[model samples]
Target chain A: MEKKQSKLSIVTNGLLHENPNLRLVLGTCPTLAITTSVFNSIGMGLAATFVLIFSNMAISACRKIIPDKVRIPAFITIIAGFVTVVMMLVQAFVQPLYQALGVYLPLIVVNCIILGRAEMFASKNGVLDSALDGLGMGIGFTLTLTAMGFIRELLGAGTLFGIQILPDAVEPMAILASPPGGFFVFGVLMALAIMLDEKQGRKVDADPEKIGCAGCPNSKNCHGEGGCE
Target chain B: MLVKSSPHIRDNSSTQKIMLDVILALCPAILASAIIFGLRALLVIAVTVVSCVVFEYLYCRLMKKPNPIADLSAVVTGILLAFNLPSTLPLWMAVIGAFVSIVIAKQLFGGLGHNFANPAIVGRIVLAVSFAGRMTAYAYPEVTNGVAALAGATPLVATRNADLPLLTLFLGTHGGVLGETCAAALLLGGIWLVVRRVISPVIPVTYLATVAVISLLAGQEPLVQLLSGGLMLGAIFMATDYVTSPYTLTGKLVYGLGLGIITCAIRFWATSAEGVSYAILLMNLLVPYINDLTRQKPLGGGKRK
Candidate 1:
């Protein structure tokens, strides 16, 4: 990614520099839906991370074998395989989280982050690099989801991980546990991420829409070839 | 080297001046709230205003943007947010509402004119959802000092055909939220804003008229519908928000009509006793489409539907 890239940087990139959620703005559907509680977010993050790592590894290893034109379908097939495994594992061991995540667990197969990384990073990089990238992105996604969940759960319920934090005088705002609060928290965290990026001497894009839609691989088919226009 | 943008012909009014005019218009409602809800009304307003200003100032400072508090928009947001809350709402809750209004609704959307919806209305809706029990608890208005001595159902909940004197409703000598109870004061403030050319009359006039028409058609008392709830306050101030309401006359009429229908539906059929805030909020989300639909065509001809 740079003049002096290292194995560690590949992993760390996903955690901070190129966070799938904060920087790439990928996998937003699951990110917003399952991030209402820290417990649920951590569970979702781990499950997605597992799927991303295996999918990236499998895709990178088969990159030479798979044709370029049919790569999206191939990559999705690989990711969906991993998602099924993880979904089953969660259902078997963590029944509560399985219930909490509900439909989102299966929907992770289509999360842009996994498919985006497989196509953009994995298809080009070595197996080691792809696995590291998956781990980093997973960690970053997990951290972001947890942060949102923590803030939302704290404000919306006046508790942190079910522990009382705020004083009795402070009334909890229950709306933060809902959809609009999810959007608000997401926007605020994005603004914070942009600011943090600037503080670290990195050039983050000022335009949110640009950052989101710029590197999207499916841009050519956006709105279905002239959709609503 | 006059590097200028569109609307080259400008008026003397500034954002600050326009905001000041709005604040002036809101004064009667604020006074009414104080008289009807007592010292706590002023307390909630003060807390919300101070917090809104502080949050905006801190966000700008931390983000290294030019301070935006000078526009006085935060103050207006604070007043309006307070207007939407019950007087008995804890000061901390009001502060949270202010934060949502200023930090989330206003600043996050790129501040001031760039906001997608009315910040105060967003704050109110957020607070209402988060603290539903506290937000809905209405206190009976005191005859002596206007502060409620105890909690009670407002006219909206009193009975199916609750009939208080029109004068009492007009004067706001009843149990309700801080600013919504007083119809006369709200009307006065609205008229003043209209006189000062601060807001277009289309939204308020059409919104109120639609509510009246719906009330009569629904076999309810139109005057009671007009006088009893937050209809006047929302029509005058919240729904007429320059940023959230439609710009064109046709769009405004549509916006008003939609608002009226939503308000009536919510008040009559929905579980909520008042629907003005939710009505304005829903309409705020639709303003952009309404503007697009009703945009003025070009001088000769424009694209057709």
Candidate 2:
């Protein structure tokens, strides 16, 4: 009963407050690549989410057994196990999506969001909380990618998920569907997200720390007592 | 009048006055663009200018900041962006260029003084990259000899490949962007800006000198290289932007030299026709580091060992 009150906040935090794509800005490699279409965005998001939940649960369950010294390797091994499962499931079921995602599906094993949460939240939290965090963050990533894909596809290709959206007169900007197009959409979306936060008297500062901390060897170690946020 | 309540110093120039001076200085080139490219070019300029000012104002309103269109900076950016575009470019595309200039490059980076790079250059590059086919479709004015040669290609490419005469290239009787064709007019406008003291001669002089010397050494006619494309306009205007270029003279020299070298490499050997825009953009990004490297010592001298 006591944990239930904070449960809602944790999920919401992943959805809005600490969204992996917009707020956390993790898993951007996949986001930029997969956001050309709504289907790819949803597929990638769900696949990553599935991997996240299981990995988080697995990591949480073994948190005590895994030593602090080699926890990173252990976490990777566990996450890789789930990612392999996801790759197999997608290949067997949705062959087209598997083909579309290509090497990226296998590349999901190294996604920062999964590895990041494993280090930050799941390792320190209970199974239920970890699962919810995965779900919320996954949904947030899904929505962001879908929105970007929808805009890019509509403007760049004049179609949405292979359906014609714009009329023939409007010559779509094909660049929006390319890699640079992905960046433009991602930038516009990020700006809008920051602006919305500002409207509520809170600012979303794109501090370099969040992204920089991921690859840092001393991420776990604070400068002194409480580490850099 | 509005004097401060203490020991104070002041300068007569403000953002508005500087912007106004730039606009005045740009008039000669603007007139030349109209004369050379025709009335359609004027339409592009008007559309871009209005859209840029409106976008700036709307952005300010949405962000709940005071209106910034009064500064006339947007107007200057508009003219510069229009100057980069071909006369044949669609008006809606010009509007897109304005949005990119004011909103993405200007407002999103917290406006004017805080913007990372020159907004006009970014806007023009974005448009160029996004619509390469449209952006490069330079509309040639009625020139007798050049009519058979590239009816729609920019002169930089044609000059390299085709047997285009240096005289024709010098006299601006070829297809190119609005400001690039008229070397004489750009020189006049650049001289006016220099005389007005709105900018120092450091960036433009160094940039042009580097390009000329390198071009001569590389066995290309320096005057032909100088007069052919947007080199004069860009070296004069875009490279000398207040908020983006380096502050120290040493920093400005390095930045200008870098730009010149890049521009020469791209034009002589690379695939692209004109590299002035990209050269300036890249150098603009390096301004902070250049400033640090060329930072002036204190008047009394306190240097780090």
Candidate 3:
């Protein structure tokens, strides 16, 4: 059905238009900490995306049976199961990343991205749509995490995934690895995201009251709408 | 018939009134430092205050705007900024800090509540980074039987690594800024502010708790961390700056917790033994966001994160 196809669109749109990490700003701690290296970023991103998809699928399947009173608890329990699985697998196989993401690995349960998608999307959507939504959001988070990691590692350590980018003469700012630097980097990136959104005619926060030049008689009443005159 | 508004009550509080109380509250610390550190401390405080007021006045005049110096907020910033610096810092550097605080941090950012970080802390950090030698240059006053300590590592530096006597740190025997040496004095000022309702305990108390818990975990003496360096001054005064801190009680608690956690981490593990100023500045930067996130809507209002 056309309705079903559009429903699927909602799931896929999150990959860029409504990305959980980049666009919506969910789960920032992992974005800041694990993004110190590209490898770690990919690892953390894939891990989080896996959790998000599974949690969304489970939450979607259980939506009808879940009581409104305890929906949050139910969703959290489902998300926690996937997060635990991710943690065990990462520790067993990816030992370096496991160590780098200490405490944050367990903290995935508190990540707003998975929980937000589960509550906002999976709670109302069908199983297939929910799974796609999870996949889209998960990949979006992964891409952002990888980008952040690439940047921090490239500048802070002068290497991208252990490859030297900058010369040895250039000294990296020690603060880049610290928490304050993490916040600064994240703030700048968010500002950049907002600027990019504007450039692409997304109009995420457009005011409906304002009239464009098309509605004006002489084009003098432009209403600052892209200087249409 | 005139339509009456739903709410008719108006409180006695204003931004100017709160800023005035802050100025008055810092007086005891300023006077105590002047008495203990002698003419130099008084000179430094006077120059810092006058320069801040002048800079603020001239900035507004040049910009063709109404002057904000009448409210004495610049005076409070000057006094607080002086308190953070070593008494031995050259008067010119202190003046530069005043200019940075008022012109760059305050006015350039649209004044008062507009700044993302505390102006004084930013000024201090600027001096700390740019003129580390002068900023860290401390001079112990001539007291009975003991030689005056010169510019060197602070008690926090010593305490960060080894066990320091709580009593020595509690009193003003350690090496730090003139105002920061005595925990009792800072506490007295904090208590006065609280008694006068100049500042709420939400920030100071929460920030202290965060630092205490983190330091305890990091194998540092909790009491020593509390008493050493600028922790008390930062918690009591700088962190509680009305314009740069969270408005709601829960938001303040969260901000304070973040400050304390970061401060303790820096003190115990990072290169700097003192992290209070940096931590407070960082939290001050987050205040607006916290206010936004924790903004409680009117009863039965719209809900969003």
**Winning model by DockQ:** 1
Candidate 3 lDDT by residue in tens digits, B111-212: 887877788898888667656676777776565655433324677766544554677677766567767877777788888889988888888998888878
Q: Which regions of candidate 3 deviate over 4 angstroms? A: A1-229, B1-7, B147-151, B161-164
How is the predicted docking of candidate 2 categorized under the CAPRI scheme? Answer: medium
What DockQ does each candidate score versus the true complex, computed on alpha carbons?
0.80, 0.56, 0.04
**Segments in model 2 whose C-alpha atoms lie over 4 Å from true places:** A1-5, A198-229, B1-9, B149-152, B299-305
Q: Which pairs of residues collide in candidate 2?
A: none
Best model number under lDDT? 1
Model 2 chain A is weakest, by summed lDDT over 10 consecutive residues, at A216-225
Tell me the lDDT of model 3 at B22. Answer: 80
- Weakest 10 consecutive residues of candidate 3 chain B by summed lDDT: B143-152
RMSD of 1: 3.9
How many steric clashes between backbone atoms does each model show? 1, 0, 1
Candidate 2 or 3, higher DockQ? 2
Per-residue lDDT of model 3, residues A132-208, tens digit only: 88888888888888777777787667888788888976544444555655765676566566557767776554233
Evaluate residue B190 in candidate 3 and report its C-alpha lDDT on the 0 to 100 scale: 87
Interface RMSD of 3: 5.5
Error of 3 at B80 (Å): 0.6
How high is each candidate's TM-score? 0.90, 0.92, 0.58
- How well does each candidate reproduce the native contacts, as fnat? 1.00, 0.50, 0.00
